[model samples]
Target: MSKLDPKLAERLRSNADGLFCAVAQQRGTGEVLMVAWMDGEALYRTLTTRKATYYSRSRQSYWVKGETSGNTQYVHEVRLDCDGDTVLLIVDQKGVACHTGTRTCFDTDILLSDSVE
Candidate 1:
C-alpha cells in the first residue's frame, strides 16, 4: 500500500542497485544536512508520513531519521531532479543532523598538504 502514485514512481530513475540518492536540506536556510538513499518503499513512507525515512545500505532496512537520536527531519517539500535520479528534501530538522554530534554532516574539511609537489 504505497501512498505515491504509480505513474510518479514509475517515472523515477533508480540506480542499478535499485536505489535513488536523496539529499536532505534545511527548509529555510537551505543548508544541506545529509545524503541518504531511498528505495521506492522508503520514498513512499517518507511522502506519506512526512518524516524522513531512508534505506540503510549497511543495515539493509528502512530507518526513520531521528528515530533513535531524536534528530527527526520533518519534510517540508520533496523535489525530484530533472534526471529523476536524485531527490531533494526540504525539511525542518530537529536537533543535530549528524551522528557525530555536529549540527550537520559536512563539518570536516580536507586541507591540502603543503608537502605536495
Candidate 2:
C-alpha cells in the first residue's frame, strides 16, 4: 500500500466525532450503492488497499465492505467533494452491494401524489 498524502489527508473535514461521509457508486453505470462513514485511517486504508473500507459507527471499528459477504467493491477511483467533507468512490462492484442481497442499498421507492391543493 502506498502512503497517503499528508496534505490531502489534512484537507478532509470530519465531523465532531472524526468521521466523514463516503458514498460508493458503480463505476460505469453510476448507480449509487451505499453511504458509509470514514475516519482518517479508514479513508487511508481504502485508498491504499483499493477496496471500499468504512468506519462502522455502531461497531466503532473499520469494516472492509463485503469482507464477509463476498460482494467486494474494487475501487476504480476516489474523489473528494468540493468542500472536502465528503468522498465519492467509483467502484467495480461484485455480487450485491447491500446486505439484503440487493444490488444497491437504495432500492426503496417513494410515491408522490399528483393532486395539489
lDDT of each: 0.92, 0.90
Q: Candidate 1, overall lDDT?
A: 0.92
Encode model 1's per-residue lDDT on 4-33: one tens digit a residue: 689988878999888999999998898899
Task: Write down the TM-score of every candidate.
Answer: 0.89, 0.89
Q: Give candidate 2 misplaced runs (Cα > 4 Å).
A: 1-3, 111-117
Estimate the Cα RMSD of every predicted model relative to the unseen true structure: 3.3, 3.2
Clashes per candidate (backbone, < 3 Å): 0, 0
Pick the TM-score winner. 1
Name the top lDDT candidate: 1
